[model samples]
Target: MSTINTSKRTIGVSFDESGRAHVLLWAPDAKQVELLLSGQDKTVSLTRGESGYWSVETRALQPGDLYYFELDGKKQLPDPASLSQPDDVHGASQALDINRFRWTDENWRHFPLKNYIIYEMHIGTFTPEGTFAAAEKKLDYLVDLGITAVEIMPVAQFPGGRNWGYDGVFPFCVQHSYGGAQGLQSFVNASHAKGLAVVLDVVFNHVGPEGNHLQEFGPYFTEKYHTPWGNAINFDDAWCDGVRRFFVENALMWFRDFHIDALRMDAVHAIKDFSPTHILGEIRQEVDLLIQQTGRKHYLIVELDLNDTRFINPVNKAGYGMDAQWIDEFHHALRVTSGQEKTGYYSDFNAVESLAKSYQDAYVYDGAFSEHRKKYFGMKTENPGEQFVVFSQNHDHVGNRMLGERTSQLVSFEMLKLLAGAVLVSPYLPMLFMGEEYGEKNPFQYFVSHIDPELAEAVRKGRKKEFEAFYMDGEAPDPLAEDTFERSKLQWGLIDQEPHKTLLQFYKELIAIRKMQQPLCVLNRREVSVEHNTEARVIVLRRQHKLQDVICLMNFSKEEQSVDVPVYASHWCKLLGSSDLRWNGLQDIPALVPGELALALPPESITLYSNKHE
Candidate 1:
């Protein structure tokens, strides 16, 4: 189905009387136009019409038909087929009937990202099989821990059996090895069955080097801007309208066809778009329109390093209207709280005071000048206390390190318990890396499997060089090693191991308490206040809603420190502490006794307590 250009650069789909597909390719340059089809010699010598145009009408292609066009004499190109590319990298261009696949979640609305908890996992390591169905088995565990959504890492088809899906050339197709098309459907279906919404991480900045065939067809990218990975996508230049539609349609397709609840746009700051209405703004409008028409809740989440709140601000305010965005301040708070000072970015936060500011205000660097960036940052969120996704450990914070050690590896078992308490209780949405609950020991190294040896070597060398000073006492893990991907897999058996099992249990308990306690889930930032000892780097926060009051504390030093209720409360109950040594699973300390219960903060430990009487 195809239609003639209406106005500007717009084209619509159309069908003939017999349901045959017809398209009018606007390119008038070719001396010949051949439709590359499965069994037909579609090399129809097109009649040249007025105004430099060529038109072709073909019998309606089947759903799985791979069709392309040979324009002029030397170009084999994907259809202006008005369908989608299921196999990124232009593998076999597919002619799709949008109505072919029946989606089951008809009455399903997307889960709200606000006050939600997310678990980010990579399909390759989620299970031994590393398929969608294999990962489905773990959905119950996430639900059991009160996680609301499962954000799978990029699933666009990449090379070989495994790689972080970032370097994928195909933005539309599901990864073939990780259960491809059907696997994705099953994964989403199973997740919805368990009441967990699915959020996908999408990369729109640039396609990888291998398998990228868009350039062979048109001006899909431009050198007008640059990104660390490659040339920036041409968003506002010539043929930029086509490139924009390619990605915008891709996003709508994910929600409309696949039932994905939300999308975390990967590193939006890296995406350079200079259009009058930025790409993010257009994507938001298109997504919201689809949601209204379908009556489903769809969220656009930006994983932005820029502290600009306009990304999450409502559309009425001339902002992007994204439902939520990732907040790195919380990560920095937890990072600082544990005395883990790995500088570079850490230079912005060398003191516990910065951590407290983040917890209270939701932005530690809220317009303050920074030494590392040497610039003021983090414009205040007009509406503070919003529930944006905050994490103690994420793929970048871990994988970008010398060795991708999780927060569990960086801090003590006790500190792991403290980190969970602080995040869950804060007035922000909480996120956990796939195995952060049990503290799995695998490192997420930067790995790729491009066919070109030079590109692979460059990636490996680049990673090694970037983290030379950050590596933990040894050489950077070999990015090209078969063992690298293998080692990245989570050890499910760790759930039964000592200390690991205890921490996993601790996570479940903490989440349960958060859901059950009104004050633990406080919704407003102004309602939460922080006071900590500058000398000892000891901290305590009090959160009070209409129903109950909660206190959270952390000791960022080797020696234990004690503090009276930082608030004017005469008596404070110790609801929980990291190093009651009860994290052993054998020891269990009852909720703290009211009336100034003594606190013992261990080295790099965090603790939580409830003001017994609200």
Candidate 2:
């Protein structure tokens, strides 16, 4: 914190008496403007105006200094109120204080997004100095791969050093080449000192085309809503009450100034509010008044593709309370649980009764009747988020595909351990995408770079004619190629190797039986129980409570079938098998005979019994 020497006009930025850095610049058509410091020799003289604001102070500023704004004697700019932009797109503007670190988690907070099992990742491709102290040395491999939370993707200060942080533009700065804001508060204080819990993915719907700067600090944007990542934020236009308090005060400055516990946000259906209490009900009444003023446990989760159930309803039911949303009906029911329906939004998901009503009702076409936006989807989502963050792969569904494959390169290996035993025993919330627990074969494509050559040839001819109905030999990848973000990082030495360490020991024993089965991690759907067969696309859910249960069974079909067993049968044991007949019940268990239970799905296999009538 330095920057000193002054003389009126400091609209906001003043400090002198040997600690220099000052700005009151209001340029009325610059005849002069100077502040340059990079290559220091200290500079700062400005006092023009006939109503074109400009004034100064000097001590030649300090705190990580990187100033600019030369103009009218040849431009140099950046600090259109910058607090940090570190060298992303032509540098300048780096004066951060953020109470100078010194944090230690302070009895940390919020982590249980209904007993999360998340893992998202991407700090400049997770490592190789992707900083946040190189992902705090893999926080004990997500606490031994049992993860409680990690999310992270949009670090809010984007533009080279990496872009999958969804091109941020300083929303209270953090991504200064991945190690800013005291390196993400020392990577969320070393991931809450290793117990986990971080979340973050921000991007309040648009900003990025090289370190934006909120339309030069003001009208922040508004073309009366139009988003596919374009002009939608201005909350309702006209200085939108300070642009809706700059995105709910930058989501309460990441939970009371960066103590962040959860925020996910990014694309609340391109958030275009009409005010009258909306702005996601003023960010759900400012996240319930910052969760009772940081008394702890925070969360806001949104990602929404607009199937909105007023985002987890129940804010005394008036709605938009939001504590969760990303259910895309579990990726349109795991991309049609196997028929390979690859098209924009999986062309209304190929039915297994719409993946058994998106696993027994989470949203299987809430408002129904849609052949892809012809009509319905009038809203639905009764709950889904006991950490309901489901995913068989994420990084925007494998970097928006177009050759980014991976559901272990598009299914198989027993439907990728039957979509990880149906999103880790579904009841909501379960994610893992860093090499989908070691099935890593690579490819997360659709990279971006655009130093505008007509926006990089209109994003490479819109990613080669938008997949002309899924992979039509079009040739894509060249998002200003740095080998397309160095081929989406994360081949972490292929976890122990063989069949990728047997799908990383069946995803570390399905996260150790959902962390030693509290009724198999009860995110509760009345103890979860589902059973169906859409003719062949099998399904089973079970879960249960009071000591034991589990079930799981899934097929998503290719052929091998067999069903019918005294309805939801009983006396079972098997316990995990994606086949090599590998159910480690000390050698796969489907021969029970005592109370009748004989199974074999095989085709795209997945099994996990142990019921005993639950």
Candidate 3:
């Protein structure tokens, strides 16, 4: 067997020991490939190497030079492994020396997965400027809010300025509108300096339709499987080794070149692979190797709709060996309990019992029948609590709606507190969408700026068709309209206002308690127990670690209900009450209580009690 080459990258443009640039392209069917340097009026022929690969080393090309690959001297296209696309996805690719930027995070260490309090933010809507530099200015605020990691939406270069980022075509290039490669590096550096880890969302399932030039190069896509976006990537068919290497190297680029702490893989279920070694497993194997070489911790968290635990299981157990995954069942159950309409996939979950099941078991539908799916779904697993990430509101949950109403607009203030409490108190890792902590009322509507008029119309029609089942009265907002994008921007000023101020304080307190309290901080599934009452619409969750114990009592009903404490402790001290006047609640709850006493819980509120004596 041939040993792997460690001197230079097998794909993309890389600089060797000398200053000369080495270029490699995988075009098996093409007879001749030429490199076109923009503004230099120079073209160099590439030598065809083994496995139909093309390679060339030249001193004429320098860092920051813009170039394109001319296939067979007939059609010109950007490099498939482009490091930067300064003029958007359709234009020329800019050569970038990622090592040129000096990093200041050498001493920074990643936080444990169990201790992660993730804050999900979209660059275009995070602030008024919507650039990486503008977002970096708010790092201190995130630190003050007790966030351990900041999860950014995809920065891959797309067609235009405004997009949700799933439409990205250049997987290796940062969005030019978001300040490009240098902007992201500065943002990550600042985040680490503030003691916050960075998690980048990446799309590997399918490339965006507009500005996609991979098929022009080689068999980069296959018709063997179909995805919601387009044809599946060529991962299992013939000539798949080069395709697999392209993506596997992309993952390594983020960790090795960009110094990213974690990658939140977007929609792994859409990725189809039938090879004996799955693509995810290959990426995991390479990431593990990188971790060993650097002595720095990194994570691969996937967004999967499937409830199968094989993705998170160890490789020895015939699994993909992913570090963690987002639990949509927990969000679905929690949403149903919060009075969301039971339509579409929401029809499968029950109110309080499903939420309880998610708390005890990581999956609510483990080996159970799903009415929405019309089949028995999920496999049971005994994975640790930290392996699952749970959230109340994310980009999909909020942006996919017809009117794009946030939880704050759809629910009451008291119920918001109750929902926030439910997520923070759970055994799994907690995630918060941007402005969710302060209950921002602005909608996170889906928007895009596709350059092609036909493609833009198609996206507008797709958005309308998607929400047809949930809404029928009004027409869905036009995704191409500029105001639609403007409407989605977060109103940072709202944090200083009435209910928003109180809600922000409430979130800070909840996060502080979660970090400081032992029972709440520990991610042990065995030490957690949940009990719910269907008639009263109440859920009582108990978490104990060693001598410390904490109980979270939630009232989902609109009317006040009396609940009996099942614990045997003699004294229980009140830690927080959402119904208290400080949080703008109507009533004042007790500060002290007996363990087995029946207590009156305010309508749509959550109260926390602990055995630790103050």
Give the candidate number with the greatest lDDT.
3
Candidate 3, number of clashes: 0
Off by over 4 Å in 1: 1-33, 38-57, 77-90, 95-99, 467-472, 566-574, 585-592, 595-604, 611-614
Tens digit per residue, CA lDDT, model 3, 1-614 = 21233223557787765878899999999999999999999998899998879999998788999999998879889988898898888899998777778999999988798989999999999999999999999999999999999999999999889999999888888998899888999999999999999999999999999999999988989999999888999999999988988888888888877788999999999999999899999988888877877888899999999999899998999999998999999999999999989888999999999999999998998898888889999988699999999999999999988888899998899999999999999999999999999999899998999999999899889988876865655778999999999999999999999999999999999999999899999999999998999888899999999987898999999999999976766778888999999999989889888767479999999999898833
Question: What lDDT is reached at residue 416 by model 1?
Answer: 76
Model 3 residue 217 CA deviation (Å) reads 0.7
Give per-residue CA lDDT, model 1, range 4-34, as digits (tens).
1211112212344465655554344456766
TM-score of each: 0.89, 0.35, 0.98
Name model 2 segments beyond 4 Å from true.
1-75, 80-114, 117-152, 155-198, 202-253, 262-391, 400-417, 426-429, 432-449, 452-472, 477-517, 522-546, 554-596, 605-614
lDDT score for candidate 1 against the true structure: 0.72
Report lDDT (CA) for all predictions. 0.72, 0.70, 0.91
Candidate 3's displacement at residue 541, Å, is: 0.2
Each prediction's total of clashing residue pairs, residues at least 3 apart in sequence or on different chains, is 6, 21, 0
Candidate 3 has an lDDT of 0.91
Q: Measure candidate 3: CA RMSD.
A: 1.5
Range of the 10 consecutive residues with the lowest summed lDDT in candidate 1: 1-10
